[model samples]
Target: MSEKSENLVEIRHLKEYFNVNVGFFRSKPLKAVDDVSFSIKKGETLGLVGESGCGKTTVGRTILNLYKPTSGEIIYDGKPIKTKNDIREFRKKATMVFQDPYSSLNPRMTVSDIIAEPLDIHKMSPSKEARRERILELMGYVGLNSEHASRYAHEFSGGQRQRIGIARALAIDPEFIVCDEPVSALDVSIQAQVINMFDELQEKLGLTYLFIAHDLLVVRHISDRIAVMYLGKMVELADAKEIYDHPQHPYSKSLLSAVPVPDPKTARSNKRIVLSGDIPSPLNAPSGCPFRTRCAHATKKCAESMPELKEISSGHFAACHIL
Candidate 1:
């Protein structure tokens, strides 16, 4: 994509922290997303992969303004997202398909009503007939049949329900979508179908995505660029092929190593870098480098100061003292 089309969503030094009460009068803040930064280009997929509590989901939520960020900036289409009105306007252009298909949907509402909800809220359609037509169009776009529209969410399988969710996201004709683990909860075969649908939808709609998932293999398959996070910080960001072939950060290397190779011969040849020790709590995260405790190349300097994300090569960034 051209540079003009390459920066659809720009996030800079974004921070989201939650205040927690410890004991009598004592309290600490939990830094869920700490100064994380990245951008998703139009028609490009930026895959975010990390451990369960590494703030990947938090990043997506904060970007969509689902959670109020403590600090930093989110600029979409050259406008800063800050005030309630700014976020309200931004919502018209952005939407999300949550991780869980079963819970994200309202079990009480029919699939048709669920998809139409956004259209009704946004007032995208002029008349009742216009709304019905738009909803059917979105359903067909996501590979759902019009016949199934009247049925409730429980009547559909995991993949089908996810399709309904995707249809709802598209109802607003959004330019951006936070696809939070859209396929993780499905069967292996169903995962492929749902993922493929997302790819197709993006192509047809010219959508930008912040695709968050723990599966490195799936992320690599769909992403144009990939960002890896450890604790609350982004450790590495690079093009998908570059990251898969040449990971720079020690934490990123470990993550790529753990993705099982399909070929038995290649899998046998690969070395798995098993990390020791558990992840530090967000309540009391380690000072300086968060990944230093598990880094084999760590030094005193690594613990003394946090490494800023610096350019390692053209379009590749990493945070490391040794690199």
Candidate 2:
């Protein structure tokens, strides 16, 4: 596909596979992210949702070049990334906010030191004074005070620790960030606070994001568009509202049906589409559709060949034989 000027990040047929040793001196390919493709416009958030182990984290890491892609192309800012130097240059503009705030940060280092690490590595700060000032500025941006800078990450609350992580991510003034379930470990109240901070930061910094999470409510709240993955493949993708209001794929419909409604009346009337059978192992995935085993609408045709993701409506895409 041709590059679009508006698209800040483009992923084409990205695949990440790991070799598992099944027996002595024997290994098999475990597909993590298989033939996934998408693009994010500048200053827009793309929410990637799927069940645990659906390759959500792998996709985020692959885009950041943390885990080398088994095969595919990653284009950032209209340029293809090919070499270590290219990745080094791209790192300046792209960063990641990891899932677990506690483990992601260095327990031994002071908060100020942790936030300043990126600046030191990239040589963004000219002198010691400049680095200190930049670290303070980043801390302030994420709602932390200079007083907290001297403390270690282990001393802070989960929310505060996440804030520090965000501060570190912003130290280099990155344009694109892959937020890999950044608030999943926090309390409900804290999750809201951190998410709001992310929104405010996005608006203030003009930052684009690939927000990966399993919570549909959180994803819907932050995403301009949403993509659903099933067993390492994208099953559906569309505007957040479009996918929620009118889900075309069976798996998408099933997932939305499970989201809890706050209203009693709505909760009582909603029908939950429960899928039978557990998710298949990626190492021994089914021949055609990975979700065929649990899909009520699955047919012989569905088992015959793998369905391609096709546009079924304006700005909506799904991979289904019935569609």
Candidate 3:
């Protein structure tokens, strides 16, 4: 694949599969992320949205090399990350903010130590004083005060804990971060504050992000572009506003229709496109498109062969037989 200087991270045909035990001695390959491809520009946020167990988190983890990919190419900053040493080097420039803030942090560790862990592992700081300064600086960047540094993770509120997680992710001064549902565990009111903080940090630090979430409203707010995933495949990808205003795929339209509008009149008039049946299991996915079983527009062609994601318009791509 050709390298683009403007792109910070490029994922091509990325697939992650897990072995599931079905019988006493038999197992099946569960495709968590299958043949996914996309690229994030320098200092841009790509929001990944899907229902639970849609492999959204797996994509983020795979990009950061947290989960070993089954087969694919991951390019970072014009270099291909293929070997162990490359992954080790890539870790310094990439980090992840996990889904659950409460479980992501160690309860025994103080906020200072938690944030300083990355620095300690990478030996980025010259001395103890420098590490302490870095930790405090990161905390301050995320809206935490110096006094809160001594407190343990359990002592802080849900929002505060998430801030600490963000601080830890930022401690390494990473260029790219895989935010795997960072604010999902927090209260509804706290969600906006944390999301806004992410925006501010991205602007202040020039960070690139792969934000994974189930909530369309939250994703639309923080993302420049959004990619909709179903089962283990990408259904549609486009600019956030373009996807919201004119979602082309059947599944994408269904997802956008469910986003609750604030205005009562608009909400009342909006038609929700309810998808039929549950998402097919990845282990036993349909032969053609992964979403065909639940899609209203599915036809005989949709069952005959899988649809390749094609550009219907400029910068808008969708995998659908009908379109």
Candidate 4:
């Protein structure tokens, strides 16, 4: 496909701010997603990685219109989403596999019903027979048996519940999926199973993904490209291998340095670049650059203004005064 045609989703200067209650008669804009932009190519997995509360999940939710964006544009398949009709149509084309599977599923509903909820909402299956058949087919895709379909979510393991969630996400036959830390809640072994299942499903269905997670190893394993976020802003984004080999931003360096290396020799040689302080509250963020508080390379320019995320190398983008 041509480069322009290759892009399935594009985000432009997306910002999602929430009004927080600080004290009596006090409020502030908590910049959850602050001027972030990127794109996901057709049938490719774009991993978004950051520490907790860095707005990774918020970005995904905002794009799907689960939480309306405070500002900026969300374009799907080259068309900008604006109207309620656009969102309704977008819902059928895109879906999410939430981070917490246990709470995401309803205790009142059976596995079959949970899987078929999207189908019913979209009026996908005309007849009851077709719905039942479709639900069974989806269950099979996620390695669940037909017998398990009638069971409640509480009866299954964490892995099984997540599978049910994934099956539901696929019910709409979506072209794009926002996977919000989909494997983080499972066991190490189960995480592998779920991650592999995602890979298999993407290949089989030609799906595009915005895979959000804090797990660097998982992101590295699945992503074609990776974007690093810090204090609600995108610090760096590049090809997965490129970022791993040579990250441009100081924050990216620190994050990658902490990823546990399996090799005894490599693990022993790797130096962890630990940051100096806890991430500052979004409600009281630094004036210039949010990462400057902990960055070793912070300079006067960094404190003066936030650097723009721009291309330093071919398809490699970073925001830092020192770089």
Index of the highest-lDDT prediction: 4
Per residue, candidate 1 scores C-alpha lDDT tens digits across 1-323 of: 36634689999999999889999898888999999988888889999999999999999999999999899999998778988999989999999998999999999999999999988887788998988899889888988889998999999999999999999999999999999988889888989988888899889889999999998988998999999999989999999999999999999999999998889999999999999999989898877999988888989998899999999999999999888
For residue 8, model 4's alpha carbon misses the true position, in angstroms, by 0.7
Pick the winner on lDDT between candidates 2 and 3. 2
| Rank by lDDT (best first) | 4, 2, 3, 1
Tens digits of per-residue lDDT, candidate 3, 260-314, equal 9999999999999998889888889998988888888889999989899999999
Candidate 3: residue pairs that collide: none
Better of 1 and 2 by TM-score: 2
Cα lDDT of candidate 2 equals 0.95
Clashing pairs in 1: none
Pairs that collide in candidate 4 are: none
Find the number of clashing residue pairs for candidate 3. 0
Which one wins by lDDT: 2 or 4? 4
The root-mean-square deviation over C-alpha atoms between each candidate and the true structure, in angstroms, is 1.5, 1.1, 1.1, 1.0
Per-model TM values vs. the true structure: 0.97, 0.99, 0.98, 0.98
Predicted structure 3, TM vs. truth: 0.98
Off by over 4 Å in 4: none
What Cα-based lDDT does every candidate model obtain? 0.92, 0.95, 0.93, 0.95
Residue-level lDDT tens digits of model 2 in 1-323: 44398999999999999999999999999999999999999999999999999999999999999999999999998899989999999999999998998899999999999999999898899998999999988988999989998999999999999999999999999999999999899989999999999999999999999999999999999999999999999999999999999999999999999998999898999999999989999999998988899999999988888899999998899999999
- Lowest summed lDDT across 10 adjacent residues in model 3 is found at 1-10
